[model samples]
Target: MRVSSIYVDGYRRLTSQKINFEDGTTILAGANNSGKTSLIDLLRVVLGGDGNLRAEDLSASARFDWLMSLVDAAIEGEDCFRALLEDENVFEKVPSVVVRIEVGYDPDTDDIRQFADYLMDLDSEKSSFYFEFRFSSKRDGMIAAFSGLYSDIRKAVDDCNWRSANDAEPGSSVFLVLQAKVDAALVNCSKPEVFFSDESYSNVLPMSTDKSFKRLFNFRAVKASRALDDTSDDKSGELNQRLIAVAKEDKNWEGVISKLPSRVVEAIHDLDIRKLTTDETLRSLNTVIESISSTNGAKQNDLFLDFHVTEDHAVQMIARAMQTRYLGAGVPLSEASQGLGYSNLIFLHLEAESFIRSAAQEENRYLVNLVVLEEPESHMHPQMQSAFIKHLLSRVNEIGCLQAAVTTHSSEIVRLSGIEQLRVLKSEEAGCRIVDLRKFHTEEIADKPAETQRLFSFLYAINFSDLLFADRVIMYEGDTERMYFQALIKAHEELAGLRAQYISYIHVGGAYAHIYKPLVVDTLRLKTVIITDLDYEKESNLSSFEKLKPLLSTNATLNEFFQDGKKNSPPSVADLSSAISADTGVALVPDTELAAVAFQMQPEGYARTLEEAILATLLDAPVWTSLTKKKWKTFRNESGLKFSIPREPESPTITQIVASTSNQKTDFMYSLILNSNLVEAVPPYILSALRWLDS
Candidate 1:
């Protein structure tokens, strides 16, 4: 049997979230504070973890409602309060942390008797059972005790108010004191309850105990803050203790233990320690001790010292002296001297081995084994992080019933794990939303197979999984645009807030920028700005000397953006340029508020690409003169080519100069950034896009 899915409600940030699991492994990935840890904690608690639920474990709204329910019940008098406390269906009415686990099994193969009592569904084809765990008040007089405490506090507050109003005495502080007492009493009465039920939870089976639930599922976790250090005396000592426990469990170690005493005694005898006692210095010391005893009138009480090595003592000594050492460096070094990364990796392997061994034991075997690894990428380099998931999966595959769930923030691990195994947790004001990418792709892109294939291929080729964790995204055309935008964001003060935000810049180019619309806007719901060039083509093969009348955009993204029911026809260049120049290129993505597109344009006319647009923008700035001088010196010195420097910014010679450097756009942009500050030379369209993203 395996856990197919988990539905959590009213648990710390997870108000009403359901997470689906892969049969083998599920990668829970999201940004910090997105309820990844809360989900893990929920799993642990529901699966018989020893942690007790406190008031803080409830969500902010749940906690408020719970307290308000008690307060309202108190205001209605003792009879109403008693009724509310005794109601068996109180959990359904009040907001409390509840988790429903759905476990799927093959009736033909699995042990039916283990989960026979939990089978609420009658259909033979149905292979899943549900178990609900919830927080509730203790029923054995604890509820009555809590009720009495709350009622007493309510009466005390009423009397205090009456006294203050009648006598004008200082009785206002009495309410705060009584409220603290009630809050403490509530914490003392809270407990967790477990029940068997159907999928919708309308049909609940007989009450279940925590021990029975523990027998069904086994859960273990490797927490993110492992506190793994080299000091053997610290928490690292747990490693030694675990080694000892595993060694004692092995049957072969019985014979080794029986022979240890004899081996220790034989080795000690070979050391010849009695020779030290026979030395002249020891003899003189013994003679002095005897004379002192005689002078004190002690006839047969002379004290003497001797060296002894009992077998039991030697065996105990050897056992306590055990230590871990690294022997690959030709000489052994203590574990304390090794690096933290290797130490953590070793610790992880040992933990997995221990859990596996425990689960495989005959008496401790469980129906399902769950091993959760939180932030396994800690202290690991990129290469190691990328490979750790596969290594862990291979190790856990030994047990056919085992399932591993890894929670990570590393993009390398996410990229390697693939989207099919991902459960992305997104934080919202109400709680969290868990997005299963497998279902998302199947439902959202079910009709568009070609686009689906193109999307996955593009994602895999660029390894753009890091965008999954960004606050927003900026998709640009090429390397030159990426380089210039990065430099500009860093150099300009107006864009300083963009630096604080986590923005992922992706190079999608003009042809495939539209391909990411579904994922960026629909799945991730990210605020996205796609910057593409308006590649204008000549109207009718006009001669270079003659003026070009009309132009058309060749960019697929812009064409699709402005496609007005026209087939095989791109948007006119004049219309696109007009929108860009007027700062009207921003359009909300269909059914989304966070995504838009920005294309290149010049105020007076159409500029073909980012390179031309930047040059045209810089024509009126002083930096343009500096760039011309630098371009002249660079070409003359590096290529031994002579060219006339353009004196007038509007001259056709300047346009020729911009066109000449098209082949080396990246290198030219790099040189331009290194020599001149282009903060004032930012193109209008690009500036609008950046400011929109910043806002």
Candidate 2:
């Protein structure tokens, strides 16, 4: 239903290229001279356009002459052309225009094939068009079928004989013809239809330009009707009379009369000019008739009327002019007048929106169909441009039109829009290359559309526009309680407000935080400390976070931590090999270990005693109680006690379990923290840092 994709082949500053479109809103962005116009021109050509891009269709002499303007005709030989085409050291002059594409759709139809129903899904390998810059499949089957036939013919030329072309299969041409018929059933071969809101349309309409209202006079007028066989003006006039007589059946001059100003209405009732002797009387009569004719017979040539604005109306006109003049636009958005630097931008945008809206139907109004705006947002304001983009996007609902392939170099626009639909148009090789955003994939947190887009763009700086990482990031909790509790801890502790400026916290979007973690870890190297409720894993002896291993394996040290430990729920921490108990009743040391103990005790679990284990790991008591006045609950919550390495909390958190209260709980917390091989991993300073530095 929308302009789903675009294809460009062998065009200026562009090589063969193809772009796939998203179902909803899509934006195409790039740097200056990055081939934006090349993209637009390619679209124009593929849509059967003329003018600048129509250069390819010119005669050989014309092509050569034009080429000579930019280069010495001698150097513009086959080698130069070859270098251009191969884009290596020379250009190659290929016989055909070269851009390829695949369009996606929802309700597939013949006129424009919805992208979803392609003959070969883009993933199919047999189609060189999948990765090659040679195939261009438009939603319009006419373009696709014709291109397919051309490709087939080219294959045949390379194969055996002309008649043996792959497209020459029985009835293939006929099938294509039928498909063409289906495509034409509703849509046209010219530019696709675009819909817009009334406000969007009025912005572009230059009605206010002609204060005399004579421009509307220049519009299509109805003088008289012509009959197919009539020859004389008289006969034509008679026929026109007949036409009007017939049309009068539905005409409502009375309605127009009612809509006129009351003074005009009264003047109409007294148009017997003989009773009006003064200049004012004549003026009133003229004004009334003008108003009547303007409203009525609007389609007739004689119906065009002029208006005289009095001082009273000047205020309204001036107000409107000021608003339009001052309107602002850009990324770091502001008001149009002061913030915007260019003039006429607002008007130009209004014009384009109107043009698009006029052709749009009520149902298809939202879809941003193909926009042909020519640098409309160029002037007026930078902030206005940014605001314009957000305003445009915020209003774009599904019912809105498809994508906008704009020609822009506004950095603000690029930043605000992210880069999902960002297509980099580049002139390379003999032709242009379009880097379709859909073609880019990233390792950043792909779970979020915005995040994925942001990270994709971020990584692209170090990488591509594919947002693999962002300079700024926000972390959300799957549970709101965790955010609340984490906030509580921050408020009570040393890191208060510090974590916020560097790393922001957020509430989870929904019940299941099934966001793709692989994507997050791959790009950002996020140190996520998931404070999940210790729910039992379906499989016992495994940790509740078992799903997190392969993802965590990227970190060697963290990998070792989970690997050496037993699989567990809250109970698993106690199951670890290092902890010991004084007797069966209690395993002392730290409150951080309480959650795991509670799980074990509630399940009627008890630790296995080992007298050798006592010698196995030495003991201590109440060493943590000496420093700060703190309840076990407050201490555990504010400064969480994970089996932190003895080091200060730098890359990984550190928690040093003191000797237990009764020499028992000491072993419990210890078992969770120390790895047997890395027992010496705990540094001396690390042990001291684990002591409450400020508390």
Candidate 3:
């Protein structure tokens, strides 16, 4: 049996959230304060033998609602308050934090006895059951106590109001006083209870105890704020502790090391310390006790203090002495000498091994094992993180019943893991939402199977997980644009603030930008700006000096952006240019206010590509003369440069010059960035795009 899903309500920020788990591992990823830690805490509290729920565990809204319910009952008559306290139905309506675990099992192959008590379905087709951990009131007398407190609060509030109405100063705020009292009362009255139910939660069977639940599920968590250090005084010998536990369970050490417990006692006895000092000390203590008894006129047997070591004490002493060491260079290095990163990694491995061994033990093995690794990338670098996740998965697969849920903020781990196992926790005003990326793709892009596969393949090849954690994204054309844009952002003061934000710059080019539309706009819902080229081609019959009609563009992304509901025909360049001038060239993605597209525009006469646009913007600048002589001389002289034609035309136009030197765009961009003030030469179209992104 495995836990397939978890439904949480009124727990911290998770007002009502459902998270589905994968068979092997379910990776929970999100920004800080998005409830990843809260979900992990919920799982641990429910399954880790500590079901204690404090007042702060409940959501702010839930707490206020529960408090108001009590106030409303008090405002009514005594009978209403009694009904709210004594009536089962009325009391059950009070708000409480609940977490429901849905377990899935195969009746034909798996042992149903593990969860037989929780089975609520009668049909054979159903293979799942629901078990809930609810934090609520579990005893009587809560009503009378609450009533007296409420009455005192009302009297205090009335006195304060009268004092304020007169000349005297008012006391503390009424709401604050009431809230503190409510929180205190709740902490004293509430407890966590376990229940069995069906799918709809309409039928519930409350378990008298959590013994069955504890026996069925084994949970372990590796928290992020671990007390890990390379110091001898470090109290958190987590790795060493797990090592000892696993070693005690190994049969190979039964007769050899396991006998040390008895040997410890024998070794202490051979020391003869009891005869040397302990006997004398006990005789002195007995004399004092007898003297005190005689003086009090009470007959009592003689008493004395003695010291002896038991097997349990010996075992504890051995455990405390154990330490982990790193072996290399013909010498053993203590954990204090090793890096914390490697130490943390070893700690995680030992934890996984301990969980696996515990489940595989023959004496009283648990039916299912679940491990929660919170921020496993805490101290490791990127490459180590990637390797750790891969190896962690291999270890998980060693046992079929083992399942792991990892919460991380590392893109490297996310990049290495399968998308099907990833769950993104997104926070909203109301609560949090867990988005299954694979399910989203299967549902949203169901019709484009080939495109979907291609998109994902390209994304993985380029580490697309970076975009998953970005607050905003900039998808531009080739490396030349990427380099130039980076330089521009750093050089321009207006756009320099982008350095402080989490912005992912993706080099998707124009041909593939349309493929990532659904993902960036629909799935991730990032604030994205796609900067592409307006690849304009010359007509066949146009004269050398005549204006080239901007009738068509070769860019697939640009074409799609300006499709305007047309099937095969694209908008003419004139219309596109007009839209650009009117600031309507880009369109916001439907239902998302953050996504838009920005492409090249004709700053002077019909600039085709980014190169043409840059040259056009720099045509009238003061640096034009030096730039032309230094960079454009090859095209102007037509002597040694390669082109479509063997002999390049002399005195080439700006368009012809750009076409001839297209292969050297990167070098040209770098030259301009190094030699000239390129920020002033930035095209108006790009400036507009950058301004929109900044906003």
Candidate whose TM-score is highest: 3
RMSD of each: 7.7, 22.1, 5.7
Ranking by lDDT: 3, 1, 2
Residue range 234-260, candidate 2, lDDT tens digits: 222222233323322333533543344
Q: What order do you get sorting by TM-score, best first?
A: 3, 1, 2
What lDDT tens digits, residue by residue, belong to model 1 across residues 41-120?
A: 77777784757776667666655555456556666667777787778976554446778889988778776567888789
Q: Give me candidate 1's TM-score against the actual structure.
A: 0.78
Best by lDDT: 3
The pairs that clash in candidate 3 are: none
Backbone clashes per model, in order? 0, 92, 0
Task: State TM-scores per candidate.
Answer: 0.78, 0.33, 0.83
lDDT digits (tens) for residues 554-640 of candidate 3? 778767667645546676665455556365445454456777767665453355567767767766421111233335555424323
Q: Which candidate, 1 or 3, would have the higher lDDT against the true structure?
A: 3
Q: What lDDT would each prediction earn against the true structure?
A: 0.69, 0.34, 0.71
Q: Report the lDDT of model 1 for residue 14.
A: 88
TM-score of 3: 0.83
